[model samples]
Target chain A: MATSTALSTTEAQRRRARRLTGEVLASWLFLLPAGLLLLAFVFYPLFYLLYVSLLHWNLIGRARFVGLANYSSLLQSVYFWQAVWNTVWMTAGTLVITLPLAFFTAQFVHLELNRRLSGLYRSAAFAPYVFPLVASGVVWNLMLQKQGIANWALSLLHLAGPHWLSQGVWPLVSIILVTTWQFFGYYTVIFLSGLQGVPPTLYEAAAIDGASAWTRLTRITLPMISPTLFFATVILVLQGFQTFTQAYVMTSGGPNGATTTLVYYLYQEAFQFFNIGRAGAVSVMLLILLVAITLVQFWLSRRWVNYDQL
Target chain B: MVNSIEPLRHVLSVPPHFLPLHPEVGPYAGAWNSAPFGLFYLNTLFMASAIVLGQLVTSTLAAYALTWLRIPGRQAVFFLILIGLMVPEQLTVVPVFLEMRTLGWINSYQGLIVPFLGSAFGIFLLRQSFLQIPLPLIEAAKVDGASRLQILTRVILPNSKSALITLAILNFIWHYNDFFWPLIITNTNHYRTLAVGLSMFFQSGSGLTPWNQLMAADVFIAVPLFLLFFLGQRYLVQGVMTSGIK
Candidate 1:
């Protein structure tokens, strides 16, 4: 009997081992496509980018080792500094317009407006986002002309509209306005969703205590939806850093490179000038800045981005 | 409104007329015939379909494996995906562009489609959805002598329809309107998608603006998306939430 039991146990263990091996094989087969693609397109390219950043590769002749020369040059380059300035301010500009408007609009519409009206509002609001950036930029390019509708409307209000595409500050502002129009609806929806997640009983309790609307919003709503607020802010900042299309389509990084954001500069350097080494340097810096920004965001979020409730 | 008016207007009138009293289809037809927008439409359709299909397949298989199977180095795969999620395309655009050039994929469909075939966002979205599927159903399938592929197709996928649709719609819209990568990879009118095509058309003139035709083209480009957005707003919004910390 003992011998028979031992034989059965060994057979069962062998079957289990075989099944485990098959499972692992299946898992690997499933993982292979995504794994290979991500590695090839994402991970390997990152290392490749770093290596290229270290060389003076111009897509002509042989690449020579340049070490940190591109980075140092970018530090002193006027165009590079202007590009950085444009990126920071444009992002800040968009955030300034978008955050308050989105938050307030979400609260007002989500709380007070009926569903029918809110749907209409959503359609109008998200239309800009739905419109292709290039196409709209093209349209806005026309609309912002000297005698175009944008200026005409300003004339209606007896206010002067600046030369939107040609002027230095106004070019950036025009980009910001278009971006705000594009993104406000999307962020409002996010804030709306976040607002909805806040428990109604908290509001009821505050109401029972005769809490005013302002007090209720400050004391209850703000703290509860802090996570969503933080998420939106992070996205806004990231989106700012990557603002290329507007500049490309609207300004062509032009009017004396007034609107040349970092990405625009990188594109010109890499493709137009074929300065692959310099572009690679810009890319590496962007990646590092992105990581540093993300880290800083997370570190700062612990201060006020509440996660306790949910 | 002015798109119709511009067709009727004899001059570039300021504060352009809102109503098209003597409207004609000349501008629309002229715009359509002037450029290869038909080909642009086809290229966009082809690229979006290829990318959406490829991303769906890769995201599903990877999500299923990571969720259902006890694979080694699961943490590493997750970490890889997280990095993929965080890194923007521009950060890697230089090297990837070089890679594409080396592969002779510049101005080719391969350049447009291959890089986006595996989306970290899609995989993450699907994984989150898959995690919510009741384990007993999968166990029951296994007990019924179903193969792993059958279980995935018949059992797992069927339950994740909404997530799948959300991803598809989002992917389709995004790639359909994507300009940056397409602009870089495709230089000629032959491979240019609609967004790139329109931008090129706008720049075709040497600062001699074609307002009527441009508006007509812009309207045509925008209307289909407006329809899609109205139809899929719920899915798009849900998809956005998924990308957030939710």
Candidate 2:
């Protein structure tokens, strides 16, 4: 009886081992396509980008190895510094206008407006976000012209409108305005969803405790939605660094390169001047900057972003 | 209600001469005559559809493996996908372009479509949805001697319809509106997507590019996406909310 039991136990162990191997094989079979594509397209290119950053090539001759030359030259270039400054300004400008307006609009939609009307408002606001950036840039380009509707509206207000897409500061501002218009609705919807997640009983309790509406909002609503707010900020910053199509379409990074954001500079370097090495360097720098910003945001979120209730 | 009706009343009171049919002449005609927008539309449609289909297949299968399959190093694979999320396309664009050039894929459909087939976002979203499926159901299927493929197709997929639709719609819109990749990959009119085609058209002209025709072209490029967003607002919004929170 003991020998028979020993044989059965060994057989069971073997079956279990085979089943485990089968599971691993099946899992790999499922993951193979995605894994291969991601590695080939995404991961492999990342390492290749780093390598290309160290080489001097223009898609023509031999890619001669140059250590730190691309990086040093990029750092020294006035145009690169200008691009960085423009990108920071554009990002800061958009975030300032977009976040506040979106929050207030979301609040109004969630709290003040009737339900049916709020749907209309949300759709109307989000309509602009659906338009392709190229299309939005074209429409806004026309509107921001010297004699366009924007100036016409300013004229009605008895104020002179600047040359929006023509001059230095105005071009950056025009890009910011178009960006804010394009994305305001998206952030508002995000905020709206965040707002809906806040428990109503908290407000009721605050009211019963004789808390003012302002105090209640500061104490309750803001804390509850901080996570979403943080997420939006991270998204905004990442996207801000990638501001290309608008500048590319509307300003063409022109008027003395006032609106030449980082990605635009990268594009110009690689495609326009065929400075492939410098472009790779710029890409690596941008990646570092983005990753650093994201890491910083993640670190900071612990202090400000409320996850207690969630 | 009164405020809304006031505008309608004012419009009704305007003279017949105020509102004219065919007010803008030759804008659409001029835009159509200038570019082969029909070709652009076909190219955009084909590319977007191909990407959506590929993403659906890859993401669903990968998500299934990550969620349900018993495998070693599952966390490591998930982490790899998360890495893909952090590395934006801009960071990889230069090398990707060079790689495409090396493969002679520049100005081709494969250049546009293949890189985007494996979407980390889609995998992440579907995995989250897949994780919500009760374990008992899967166990029951296993006990009934059902194969993993059958369980995934007949059980898991049938239950993940909303998530699958959401993924498809979002992917379609993203690829349809994508300008940067198509712009870099395709230089010729024959291969250009609508967004890239429109930009090229706008840039090709010198001064005094016709404003009305440009606007008409912009409308033509934007309308389909606008319609999709309106129709699928729920799924889009839900997708955003899901991603934002978790």
Candidate 3:
């Protein structure tokens, strides 16, 4: 009887081991489809991008391998540096307009209104976000024409509106304006929802302590919403770096290349000019910029992003 | 302000009118009939639907595995997946374009749809949602002798319905709005989506564009997306809030 029992115990142990293997296999099967797709597309292309950046191929036969020559040419090009400068200023301009406007708008909508009114206002504000950038950009192009309503509105204010779609600062400023108009509502919704999550009891406690309105805002509200703020800032900057459709439809990288961001420059190089090697170098530079900025933001986020709420 | 359609002399008057006093569909008809707008709509619908469906199934399964399965190298895999978020899509487009050509998928629906089938954002969001489901609930399901798939469908998915819908709608609308991939992949208008097609229609008249017709085209292109935004606003808001805060 004792020997029979011991044999049964060993059989159970073997069965358990097989079952463990089955579970692990099941888990892998679940992940396999997604893993393959991401590996092939998202992950593989990154390394390929790095590799292609080192090649000197147009849309022709035999991509001749070149080392750092493409990058050197880009570094020396006036047009490339101009694009880099334009992209930087455009990002800074858009963020400056976007974040403050969104925050204030959210505060007004959430704090100064009843529930019904806020809902109506939120939908109205976010409606612009739904439009395709190319389509609205078309409208803006027409509206900024010499006889357009944008100037007519400026006439109503007794201030002349500059030729918005023209070269120099106007084109860059126009792109920023349109981008801000389209996207501020998105950030506003994020901020509004973040604001909603803040417990009212904390506000009441501050009120009881005779805290100034600014004090309540600075001390309680901003700290509580820092995670959302950090998320928004990071997302916005990443998006700003990739501003393309607006520049594409509105200006076509322009009369003097005034509004050419990195992406527009890359597109022009790849498709129009067929400068594949140069485009690859631009892509590599963009990749480095994105990865570096992302890493720095994440590292810096630890300082101020209040996750103690979590 | 052009008050009406295609009376260009009146439409391009010094000051634009607020109301469409002489409301007519002349420009709308012109815009609609001008291009293969209907085909463009159909292409976008099909493409966006395929992407949404593929992403949902793959992301849900992957999120579940990452959350519950005691697999080796899981952390490294997760980190690698998260790297997808850091790299911009534009940076990878060239290589992806080359790969698509090599696969003979250029100008095909597969070219448009395949590269975007797996979304890292969807996986991350769903994983976060699944983690929010109480472990005790999953434990109870397992104790009842439920198989892994059964437990996922019965316990985890039922609880993550909102997150699932959010992922679906977001992916759908985003792909619908997408122009870059389609512009690169499709050399012909046969498989072109609306955004690119619309831009082509606009540029069809390179020097002298019909402003009224262009506005009409813009209106039609925008209305469908506006409808979608309204339908998905609540869940979209919830998804964004959850993704950011936690």
Candidate 4:
């Protein structure tokens, strides 16, 4: 009887081992398509960008192996520095307008307003987000036509309308203003979510301690939602670097290159100049710039982004 | 992972390229001024309708399949869609444009509409929402020999209204703000949408842009969506709270 039992147990163990192997095979089969697509599209393009950067690749000529010449030339170019400056200034300009305005509007809208009115306010604020870039650009163009409603409105108010799309200063403003109209609601939505995470207990305690709305906001609400802010800022920085469509569609790199952001410059080099090698080199720089900016933001976020437990 | 593109307010603050000759008279002075307003409203309405309609059909079917269909390679398909979440739209420009050109659909609504049929983020969001539906209810329907299609339409969808709406709003904002795809595909003014139209206006170089006119036009595009959001604020808040955090 003991010998028979031992033989049965060994047979059961063998069956279990075979089942485990079958499960492993099934899991991998299920995962294969995702892995293959990632390798082909995501990793291939990334590596190809590097390979193209090393060659004197243009549309018309053979791609001769030029080693790191493209990178070196990009580093020395004045346009590279100008793009960097534009990216930083645009990011700062956007943050200044968007962050505070979103926060204030979110604070007010999330307060004890009537339900119907609150809905109107939220939808109205979020309206710019719905029109495609093409539509927004067209609408703004028509409105900003020399004797457009905007100037007419200003004319009524006895103030001269600035040529916002023409000169350097207002072109930058044009890009910034359009961008803010699109994003403020998104940030507001994100901020509202972060605010909900903050318990009412904290607000009640602050109120009991005679804290003003401004004080409670600065001391309590801001700290709690720091993580969300950090995430938003990271996205904003990445976006600021990739600011192409507006420059492409609205300004076309400028009223004298005032809005020629790095990505747009990359697009022109590759498509217009047929300088594929230079474009690859520019993409490489952009990748590096973005990674560096993200790292810095992550490091600074530790100081202010308050993940609490993290 | 669905995200919105930035709008162009900065351009709106600029003046018109060439001011129209002012009729030194009454309300007709302002009536013509509102042409930009009419243009803004028209563009916004068109974009919003297309986006909401596209998202409703695509997300519903994709979500249903991922949730209920007991097909071979189902998990594989879901994961494949999920991989699209991280790929920036810019990367797809060359291939999509090539595809559109081949189809002879360039500068048409079909070119704009067809490619977006597969929305990975929408599928994922709706799938998550479907996952929240209690299993026992579905099982009870199955026991009654209900068709899989009937179960999805009757049981799963009704329970997931809030999630569906949230995904719709998200898709609305995203497709509305899209510029690169529309710009590359469409060539003429007749096909030009708002973002593309604005770009042409800015680059036309006929003259300086009038800031107030731009701002007024900017107001027109922005106001409608803002009003809708206010109406849906609670649901929007609830949508974000559940979708991302949970």
Candidate 5:
């Protein structure tokens, strides 16, 4: 009995050691390709961008070390500040317009509409979301043209339509409006799913207790969908910072840079003018801005987003 | 004729659908003046097909290896893929362009197809789906003396159809809509995709980009994607619901 027990114990130790080795080996094999790709493409490029940011490098010329000059120049450049302001304004405009439209649409679909109509409305709202960013830009630019359908409709109503493409603020407004139209459906769908997750019993109880629709929304629905709201906002903000396609297609940061966003500026510097070093600096700045915003989001999420409420 | 076709009549006479429709084809309701519509449609179909096929094959292989095989350093590999998710494709634009140029693949299908084949997001999403496949099924396969490839093909893949479809649809839509990579890589009109071709047409300084023509082009590019999504929307939503927060 003692010999058998000792033999079994030894076997158990061997099995444990073999399993550990297997796990370690398995993990390495699974991870190799993904790790190598990220390391080459992500980490390498990021550090290279940082390194280039400190230099006075154009595409053709040798990169010369110019520490802090690019950073200082960028900080001082009024164009940089204007682009930053434009990006912030555009992001804010999209959020303000999209959030309310999505909220009410979610409510309409979830609370009021029948399944069939809800499906129709849901698809209608979401139709714009699937359009390629460039395609949406093209379509909206057409719709917003000086003598386009929008103006034609306005003329029929005897109201003067603004020159959407050529004008200063109107182009910005047009871009924001188009972006919202394309994106609002995604958020609405997200919000509807959030609403579905909210237990119907709570809403029923609220209704019985003399809570108005507004009261129920503020007290319950809003809190319940806060997590979804958080996710949508992060995505929106990230896209906003990375706004390039629309600007590239529609305005090209036109009408004297009225809509020149930071990413557009980066594109101009990097690709158009071939100012590689400066572009790298700008990319680094953009990354920093994104990181800062993400930190703020994390902080706010902790305070308001209710993950455990469900 | 549309009125005689009841289902067609309701769709054609609607507010959104009140736009234009070309006979025997999809919506081309707007003016067809600026450029021929044929170019954009063919280009978009070609690009979307290439991207979807490449992404599906590459990502599935990567996911399969990661999930089923007792491969070495699996966790580390998975983490690397996750990191790829965060690296903006913008960063690699220059190098990729250079690589394409060196390979003489610039302005060709090869340029568009090769670099975008391995998507970290696709790998990650499919791996999540693969992980949920029960271990008992694989054990049962083992009892029958099934090889690894047989288990993957016969058992795991057959059960993971929803996940596969979801990935395909997402990939198709994303590739169909992507502009930047296409714009950077392809220069000539012959080589352009829908997004790139449309932008080039608009920006060609060709008589102020005739509004009706542009919107018509937009309709052309968007309608097929919209149809696909509308058809598969339930599955798309289900996929999102199933996939955990990244």
Candidate 6:
């Protein structure tokens, strides 16, 4: 009887082991499709991109491993530096214009009297964000034409609009304006949500303290919404770096490469010139730059982004 | 200043007789007849649908495993998947293009659809929702002899309607408006999506693109998303908020 019981226990243990193995197998099976795809496409491509960045190969020719030659040449290129500068300027310019505008619009829309009107304003504002980039670029192209509505509107103020898309510096400004217009509503919505989360009692208490509106805004609202502001700045900067369609369509990265941002330069390198190696180098630089920026932003957010509520 | 602007406003206003649209030659008709936008629309619909469906299935399965399965090294696997989120598509464009060329998928629907099928964001979103499901409920389902797949479809999914819808809508809008991948993958009008097609249409026929027709095409391309935003603005806002906070 003792031996039989021992045998049965061992049998049960074996059965349990089999079931456990089956469960693990099933779990892996579930993860396999996503895992394989991500490995093949997203993760593997990163390593492959690094490898390709070292090679001098057009699509047709056999890849000749050139080590860091591509990187060195790109670093030496005037166009590459110009593109980097343009990207930085665009990000800074757009952030400066967009953040304040979005904050104010969000504040206005968040007001009690404007509550009913908020939906209308939000939809109208966000309408531009949904338009395909190419389409918006096209519309902006038309709007920024010398004889277009924008210049006509400016002429109403007796300010002659400079050639918006055709001139050198004006194209950069035009690209920034178009990008800001495309993104302002998105940031506004983000800020509006943040604003809504700010407790009304704080504002009421400030009012009872006889605090001025400006003082209340500076002391209370800004601090309360600094987290959102930080979030918007990170996203806007990222979007600014990814500016391609506007420059591609509205300006074609020209009036002499004035509007050429990093991605545009990368595209020009890879597709236009078929210099895959140099484009890969640009891609690596852009990736490192963005990731570094994002990390630094996160680190810096500790100083200013208030997380007291949560 | 107000009095001076009134006359100018009248002059700037579109003339009452000047119609933006005519009876026979509407902007919609003009744009539609001018380009193969119909083909572009169809291709975009097919590609978007394929991407959304594939992402939904893959994300759901992966999230389910990560949440409920008693698998070893699950955290490591989750982190491995999350790494995809950090690597931007722009960074991978050249290598992916080469991969597509090697796989003979260039200008093919698979090229556009497959690489995007497994979204890290989708999986992350779904996992968050799945993790919120009460453990006791899942245990009860198991006691009733419900298989993992059965519990997933019957219990976990039905409870996650909002999350699933959010994923679906977000994926649809994103892929629908995506330009970069489609631009590189497809060389011809055959597989061109609306974004790429519109761009090519604008850039081609060198002298000048017809502004009115292009704007009309833009309106057409944007209408679906506009309708979606108006109808489901709450879900989109919720998704964005969740992403931001998380």
The residue ranges of model 6 lying beyond 4 angstroms of the native Cα positions read: A1-16, A113-115, B1-27, B244-246
- B113-216 in candidate 6: lDDT tens per residue? 99999989889999999999999999999999999899999999999999998888878888899998898899998899999988887887466556556767
Instruction: Give per-model TM-scores.
Output: 0.97, 0.95, 0.95, 0.69, 0.85, 0.92
Evaluated at residue B126, the lDDT of candidate 1 is 95
* Higher-TM-score candidate of 3 and 5: 3
CAPRI category for model 3:
medium
Model 4 C-alpha lDDT per residue in residues A1-310, reported as the tens digit of each score: 9999999999999997786566445444433443443444344556677777787866466779999998898889998778778877887899889988888787777776666786667666655555555546555555555655577789878998888778758877888887887778777767766776888888899999999988998889899888877777776666777788777766777877888888778777766787777787787777777767778888887778776721
Off by over 4 Å in 2: B1-25
Clashing residue pairs, candidate 2?
none
Model 4 docking tier (incorrect/acceptable/medium/high): incorrect
B202-246 per-residue lDDT for model 4 (tens digits): 455355543334443344444555666666666665665554321
lDDT of residue A190 for candidate 5: 76
Tens-digit lDDT string for candidate 5 (B74-115): 688778777677666665565455456668988888887667
Q: In model 5, how many backbone clashes occur?
A: 15
Model 5 lDDT per residue over A6-121, tens place: 99999999998897677556545544554454455456667767777888877576779999788899999998888899899999899888988898889889988989898778
lDDT-wise, the better of 2 and 5 is 2
**CA-based DockQ, model 4:** 0.17
Candidate 5 residue B163 Cα shift, in angstroms, is 1.4
**For candidate 1, lDDT tens digit of each residue in B96-176?**
999999999999999999999998988899999999999999999999999989999999999999999999988888888
User: What's the lDDT for residue B75 in model 2?
Assistant: 95
lDDT of 1 by residue, A224-250 (tens): 999999999998898889889899989
**TM-score of chain B, candidates 1 onward in order:** 0.94, 0.89, 0.94, 0.78, 0.83, 0.89
Error of 1 at A24 (Å): 0.9
Report the TM-score of candidate 1, chain B only: 0.94
* Location of the lowest summed lDDT over 10 successive residues in candidate 6 chain B: B1-10
What fraction of the reference structure's interface contacts does model 2 contain?
A: 0.68
